[model samples]
Structure formats: C-alpha cells, structure tokens
Target: MHRARADCTANTSDPVDGQAMHRARADCTANTSDPVDGQAMHRARADCTANTSDPVDGQAMHRARADCTANTSDPVDGQAMHRARADCTANTSDPVDGQAMHRACADCTANTSDPVDGQAMHRARADCTANTSDPVDGHAMHRARADCTANTSDPVDGQAMHRACADCTANTSDPRIVQQCKEIVLLVLLTPVILWVVKPCTGLVLVVLLTPVILWVVKPCTGPVLIVLLTPGIPG
Candidate 1:
C-alpha cells in the first residue's frame, strides 16, 4: 500500500511539470508574434512618412519653378520697355532736326538780296515760317528794309526803281507803301509794251536832237554802267 501511494504522488507531480512546459511554450509563441507585428508597424510608418514627404517636395519644386519663371520674365519685360522708349526718343529727335534745318535755310534765303533760286528754296522757308510770324522771319524783313533804305539815295533809273518796287512788293506786307509799290511795278511792266506800240515820231525826233548831249554825258560812265547792267540784280 505504501508503494502504490508513492506512485500516485509521482504521477500527479509529472502532470504539473507538463502543464508548466505547455505554458512556457505558449508564452514563447506570443513573444515571437509581438516582434513580427512591431516590425510590420515600423515598416508601415516609414512608408507613410515617405508618402507625406513626396507631396511637400513636389510643392516646393512647383514653387521654385514659378519663381524662376517670374524672375526670367521680369528682365525680358524691362528690356522691351527700354527698347520702346529708345525708339520713341529717336522718332522725336528726327523731326526736331528737320525743323531746325528748315528754319536755318529760310533765314539764309531772306538775308541774301540777290535773287536766290527762290522757287527751289521756298518749300523749306515756307515750312519753317508758315503761319506763325516767327521772330526769325521778321528779323529777315528788317534787314532787307535797312539795305533798301541805304541804297535809296543812289541815282534813280526807272529800271532800278521798278526792280526795287517789285522786291518790296513780293517780300513785305507793310501797308504803308504796298499800293504805291504795286502801281510802280505795273507801270514798269507795261512800259516796254507802251514804248513798242507808240513808236512816237515826235519822241524819236526829240531823242535824235538830244542824242549827242546824252552821249557826251554817258561816254565817260559807260564802263561802270555796263558792269552794273551785266551784274544780276539782288532782290532787295
């Protein structure tokens, strides 16, 4: 009976040991599964972080591209504006130069009493002096008047008087003597026609009678008179 009791005790202890072993095995399996799950979570977190960072990097790149585009366009726009201004300045300068040239030419024309190729020079003078009674045009007229006044005391030849009258009529608008000057010009223009038509026999007789007296007075002065006659008359 003693031996049988001892054997039963031994059997109970063996079952207890087996239970402890089973418990230890279950704990090991749980521990292994925990590490695997932790590793998977770590991988998932890393993948999520990368995904989030990708959009931020893409946005940064987009902003950089926009900045570069704007920076590049600014200089181009500035250059275009500069070119436009330069073109406008050049266009404006040309007209001013042309105007100055015209005025200078007009002044030169008015100062010279000799019949300039007036027709050829008229366009330039007209353009410069057109509507505004510019001081420059007025000054030229004053100079012409002074020249005429200086020469007025010289001997009065009808032909010279006619020429002077014509010059004054064409160049001046002073009303004081304009009508008289015009009449003088008309008389001079008509004189040749009148002389040719009349051919007065009485006038011829008088001219024959005075011819010797006229010749004596004129002979000594002929050289100077011929020179004056040959020289082209100045406008003033």
Candidate 2:
C-alpha cells in the first residue's frame, strides 16, 4: 500500500512540470516578437520625420533667395525706364539718337506756311536790311571807297612811297633810289594834272599841301643830289 501511493504522487508531479515548461516557452516567444515590432515602428517614424523636415526647410530657403534676388534688381530696372523717359522728354519727338531736336527744328522751318512764323522771319530780314542801310554806315563806306581809290591812283606810285622820306636818298647808286627820284620829278611836274583827274577839291587841296612837307621830310639831302644828277652831265 505504501509503494502504490508513492508511484501515484510521482505521476502527478511530472504533468505539472510539463505544463510549467510550455508556459515558459510561450512567454519567451512573445518577448522576442515585441522587441522586433518596436524597432520596425521606430525606424518608420524616423524616416517619415526626416523626409518631411528636409524638403520643407530646403524649399523655404530657396524661396527666400529667389525673393531677395528680385528685390535687388528692381531699382536697376526702374532707373533704366526713367532714363528712357527722360530722353524722350528732352526731345520734341521720341528721342532715338543724337540730333533729334535739331531735326525737329529743321522740319518746323520747312513747314512754315503758318502766317505767324513767316511774319517773324520777314521781320528778322527787314531788321538786317535796315542795319545795312543805316546812314552813318553808308557815309563811312563811301569815305572808305574814295580813300582807297585816291590812294591807289596817287601821283606818287606805290614803289616810290617809302616808309620814311629819308629812306629815299639812302643810296644814290641804288637802282631803287633812281626809280624813286624819277617818280618824284614826274610828280612835281604833273601836280595840276592829278588835281584835275582826282577832281575832289578837298582831296586836291590835301595833296597839294601834304606833298611838299612829305617830300622835304623824305629827302632833306635831295637838293644837292638832284642838282648833280639831273643837270647836264654832272658825274653821278
């Protein structure tokens, strides 16, 4: 009876031990599965956060730089527009190149069928004529003309008229002096003929009076020289 009781107790202990081993194996498998699932979820979250934040930040920076570039270039464009408008304002027409205003003014002149513009041009021409016909200017012109004519045809030719009368008798042997002496002698003989031809009484009187003073001043040594040369066969 004691042996039978011992064997029954052993059989009960073996079944209980088998059930405990199955429960332990199940707990270990669940623990391992839990860790793998947690790791996979963590990696998915990390990938999603990185993808979202990187594109958002990069796009924001790109937009800011584009806006900055546009703002910086605006004033440069405005200045170019203003300069073009200023050129147009300065010209009578749209300013294309140099001489635009001058060309416009020339065209305005050509199309002057307008009475007011024609009258203005006429008045300018009349004023020019009046200035030319002023009595004072006319009288001065006449006097100048008379003087030039008389001086040109004077009894003393240009070659004989020295800067100073003393220059005339500078050298008796000089051919120039000989020519001058002949002109002077001819002038003395033909004084009356010159007065008649030039015919202005005032001019004649000035010639008559100025001639002797000029000759005397020119040739203070003339009397002796002329007596020796002009008189019969005196040695030169």
Candidate 3:
C-alpha cells in the first residue's frame, strides 16, 4: 500500500495520463490498505503500470524510433538523405549519362542503357554536334576538304592524315624533288583512304611518305607514285 501511494505521489502530476490517473485511483481504493489514499494509490498504480506501448509509460520514444527509419544518404549524391533508400532510386550511376548529351557540357556521355564499354566509346560525345554521335564521327568519312573543319568531306582527311601530309614536306633541298614528293604523297594518301581497314598497309604508306626519299623524289614525278605502289601495295 505504501509503495502504491509512493508511486501515486510521484506520478499523479503526469500530464500525459488522465485515463491512467482514474485507473490508478480505482486500483488504490480497491486495495483496502490503511494510512494511504487508496484511490490515489490505485490510480497511480494503474497509470504507472508501465504499458511499454503507452506514451504515459515512457514508450513515446520507442514508438517515435519505430516510426522513423534510418536516414540513409544517397551515394551518388552525398547530401540527399532518404527514409528507406528505395532500390528504384538512382543507384550510383550518374544521372547525366541518361540525358541527351550536350555539346557544351563535356563528360555527359555514358547514357543510360549503355553497356560498360559504351562510356569509353562515347567519351568524346561532348565535343560532338547535336546530330553527330561522337566527336570523331563529325568527320565526313575520310576524304578531307581543304578547310578540314569537322572533316566536312566524306572519306575524311582526318587530322592524322593532315599531320602525316604535313610531315612529308620536310627536309627538301631540291625544288624539283619537292614537287615530285607532293605527287607521290597524294598517291600514297589516296590509296589508304580507299583501303583504310588495312592499318598495316596504310602504315607502310605513311612510312614512305615520311621517309623523304631523295632518290625517289628525283624520279621526276612518276617515279614517286611507282615507288609508293612498290613500297606498300593496296592490301587485299
């Protein structure tokens, strides 16, 4: 009875419990213990019965915790936190990859649905125009136009061929030889564009172009073309 009265004294002022207060009073009154406010004892007893689920019994924190899941921060975007981190949420993949690639925005490649290696192939997509799929694809095939901007001419004369041609005109002492070298260079360059798939044949042609063969250059103009044919015939 004393213990019940003590609990009643301690918890009668509890603000969260009006119904429990009444129950506590009834339990104390029914006890028939002397020198104690039996009603208060009973009421406090019922109120303080410690229903683990009840807010009045200090279970408010437990309920609140149960209601709240862990706040998981998204890995792709470090700051955004989600309650449950749904699987459908953007995993670690960059959202930019899925959108239309912008020419001005570099690194927007690796679009969604692309395989893993697709990113490597599309790395230059940022420098490409809207209609162009890749930066290199902007070249019109391989036949180079004079301007060479975006290699507008099909059969693209890409920068590699241009640079190769430029390398050919080096270290010429004779005027006649220079003209002959130009002719030979054009023939050598033309063959590669037609059979571009044969890298080795094209590479051999490039070597001849770059060699600055003084003897062949002196072969009046026809000699250079013949030498190109003999040096690296078009691969089958």
TM-score leader: 2
Pick the lDDT winner.
3
In the range 14-109, model 2's lDDT, one tens digit per residue, is 222232111121111111111211211111111111111011111111111111111111122221111111111112221222111211111122
User: Candidate 1 lDDT (Cα, whole model)?
Assistant: 0.24
lDDT of 1 by residue, 1-236 (tens): 11233222111112222221111111111111112112111111111111110111111111111111111111212211111111111111112222111111212232122132221111112222211111223322222222243222112111111113313534343343445555544543343345435765554444445544543444433454335433532212
The 0-to-1 C-alpha lDDT of every candidate, in the order given, reads: 0.24, 0.25, 0.32
Query: Regarding TM-score, does 1 or 2 come out ahead?
Result: 2
Runs off by more than 4 Å, candidate 1? 1-91, 94-138, 141-189, 199-236
| Per-candidate clashes, comma-separated | 1, 1, 20
TM-score of each: 0.17, 0.19, 0.15
Report the C-alpha lDDT of model 3 over 1-236, residue by residue, as the tens digit.
Answer: 23344334333332332323332333432321212111222223322321121211212111122233223334554532222112222213345454321110223333233232233112222332111112233221211222334323222111222112212232232234456677666765575555455676666666557445633554445565566656655455
